[model samples]
Target: MTSPAPAPETVAHDDLCPICHLLLYAPVRTECNHLLCASCMAQWADASTLTRITPSSLDMDLSAFDPNYDPTPDLEAGCPMCRTLTAAVPDRKLAGFLEARYPAAYAERRVEEETARGSRVGEDGVQGMMILIGNRHRAERGGDEGPNKHNWTFFVRVSRPDIVKEIRVNLHPTFRPPRVVLTEPPFEVRCLGWGTFTIEAELVLNEPYGWVKDGMGSRSQSLELSWMLDFEGRGKQGRVRAKVKKLDGDADHPIDVDARASPVNLPHMDHQHV
Candidate 1:
């Protein structure tokens, strides 16, 4: 019998943040192509006294505008290392990649983070909200091009949108600025990749709503979740209906239909303009 192949892993050898001088955790990418831990970047940006338009951390949803919206610019602080604009987004993709290549070390980093953040959420038995994971991949040239070289879009849906104050997506570190926070509806993230990877997120509830009782009658404000991206699954795989015609030369796409076997674009995508 032949043995199965091992999973792919892209490791970063001692990828440390310039500010913290520690392994990048929930890292973010600066415009100058520099990597820094998300918390470190946040602190740096916060320390900035720039009177410019600081981007809001809360991802916005222009519901009426639907699929088109402007992305806020990066913060106006000089990077601690390069003195470039501190503008950065969570480099969850890199985090994902690092986690894959250094599972034990990455796990230790996660534990450190959790510890600094008050350890685990109270195990009140309450799950907080349900997380639905989905994905859609488009071949290079309508399946005639390159199938192995396609983009992978990973996203999530919240069970209780009303109570969800914010949805923070922790993408596989393989993606730049792998962490994303959505303050509006249709919480999701898009990244270009060839294969599937893990996805994680947490739903931060509005104070009182955050506290809840579970079936076993316990209370906690934790709604952390993890899921694998399924390219061959059915889970409403698109934000707005995407057409191959507008995409490439296939014009006769089904009018305004979601879940086509093609690529998709939606508004408010973390670090994604289209």
Candidate 2:
């Protein structure tokens, strides 16, 4: 028979991007404090915004008017959906303005781009864990239905040496998407499935804290999650661990998962992290 897959390599520390599961290229932060792929964040935001807006048909009544509303205020931030902060934007307000403007059909382009990047992963062979996070739906052209909402999902599996544990994982979606940067640290995105449960990760810094300069100083942050799973081995039980990091060029960041529970009989349970 063919050789089995090798065990995951252990590194010094978990330093990869949780979103892209790669190196943090240009990082951005969410309101609840989670990281994302800079470019992916940008597309998600743009798509969300385009899906949220509906053009007036010029045939409505006076009740539709809000005296306190100003069209200028709505355009205040560029792509309100893409809300992460970055260094290239010295004037944060300016970036928001640009995002609001239609950049030659950016939404469609974003979907295509994301699809191309996602086509690189392989298939899964067994039962796994999936986390559906958030999704955005952009409005289709020639329509007044506004933007449709899409949901994002993440999947994880026990590849090598399965074990047992009662641990849980959580992901918070209350924060707005962040802006994409170009010259800062990079992040990673782990592919945990074959069909539709893949997620992109980024290094999002909490508000009032700010981005850290490379080689200067490091910032402490944690990703907010919302789900957990109880894994139990069917045969001889052991230990397993899950970690996050960024993915560089052709190099895959290593993951170590060890679980332990004798006579394993893991009954799956669902719980959200507070």
Candidate 3:
């Protein structure tokens, strides 16, 4: 029998990155056996270099000096806490622990990685996508709520942009296919409706391609997006929460989309009509 997974609260302190004081993301193990976020390590490496050469007095100019010219090259990449030289290597064990113990944090990290990698677009140029549904009302009337207003968008463009014919996006069981063919990256559409649904996207590639036979003409693949949205209160006075499900792709795919709720004030809009 397997042991039960530890609660997030129980593993919070152990899983936190020392540098960020938050849950570890893309954690790496040091030679000193300490774990830190990959991003934190990168930032610390730069800061450590600055600390080594930075003059205490602002009057001094160090611009002419080479930043990479370290007096003690062997002592580079020291741990901020222990001051012990260390190397950053992915801690698979710690990563698994975080995935099991703190799934939300892990998911958030995945989203950030995807965004940093240009929306998870791969070498093949066929990549996963994120669909963002924003509250127009909240966007128009600025509030303490930040810019997004519960919107997150991700999508992949055709590899051979020149040869690509068209793209079709179908919102399962409800809306009709868009009248126009998508020729750009966004592939977005506008509609007024509520309730969660599946988004079926179809990509049509040009003919004479490697994947297609000479007589077979075009080639295509279908990707699906299924997510959830919730409304907490009555019409126009409620909040909206949304999240994206695991994308439909190969096992090794790196894209993971997530979202947070923003206040949805639709006093003028009626759900009865929707």
Candidate 4:
């Protein structure tokens, strides 16, 4: 019997937005089928004026009465490339393709935008830290099978190495009471397991800081993190960061956070059944 031919591969084109000259973000398609970034088109529409007005009379009082006086500027929108009047619509397929093909670029852009917005710090005087979790082994495999298989070693990391004193990682009932501890920077741990768990970290602060009531320290501030290991859109690994804040009554909460994974490394996989 002859073997069936391999399925044809889909190739992505190196298409760049004319305005940004880079991979499109939130791409939109004009009626002419040309693609452009949504933000870029919006900006062009605001800047480009369809009509220009000149007052016939120089007198300020009679300017309003002048026949040639047109107060409003025409802001009709058109394609920046072809100058064709068309309505831009969201191109979901192209958006998905850009995200999947350029995962690193998208992640970097997200980080840059977040940083520009000053989201790395909390208003409550708490600092921000990054938590990187993933399996290097699975990443190295570079195959479809490893991503789908659940048996892999996972790791966790803290970005602010200088402030962290100790890290305690605890897996649910599988690995209990004896929490894994690390006393240094790169507070990362590796283990072979699946599911979610709690992480607690002790911080080396400049002075005693926490919820103090009636001249007594009620609760010490700690960075508590929880994450789950599941192969969904996050292929082999992913990274997340949050701002740690000390709340009233000694409660700690992380906020103003972000998480991202590479679509290239973790492409959507199809399941096979026997």
Highest TM-score against the true fold, candidate:
1
Best by lDDT: 1
lDDT of 2 by residue, 1-274 (tens): 9999755433212223354454332334445344443443433332212111122232332235454321111111132234443211122343343334423323433454346543111011011111122221222233466432222222222221122122222223322111111112111111111112212222232222211111222222222232221111111111111111122221221222222222311222122211
Global fold similarity of model 4 (TM-score) = 0.30
lDDT of 1 at 52: 19
Model 1 misplacement above 4 A? 1-131, 141-147, 211-216, 233-267, 270-274
Model 4 ranges with Cα > 4 A deviation: 1-126, 134-151, 176-178, 193-220, 231-241, 244-274
lDDT string, candidate 3, 126-176, tens digits: 221212221222122236753322221212233234443344444434433
Each candidate's lDDT (Cα)?
0.48, 0.26, 0.40, 0.43
Worst lDDT 10-window in candidate 3: 235-244
* Tens digits of per-residue lDDT for model 1, 147-189: 4444555555544456656666766666655666677776766
For every model shown, what is its TM-score relative to the native structure?
0.36, 0.20, 0.30, 0.30
* lDDT rank order: 1, 4, 3, 2
Better of 1 and 3 by TM-score: 1
lDDT of 4 at 219: 32
Task: Give the per-residue Cα lDDT of candidate 2 at 179.
Answer: 18
Candidate 3 deviant stretches above 4 angstroms: 1-11, 48-75, 113-274
Residue pairs clashing in model 3 are 129-154, 129-155, 130-154, 236-266
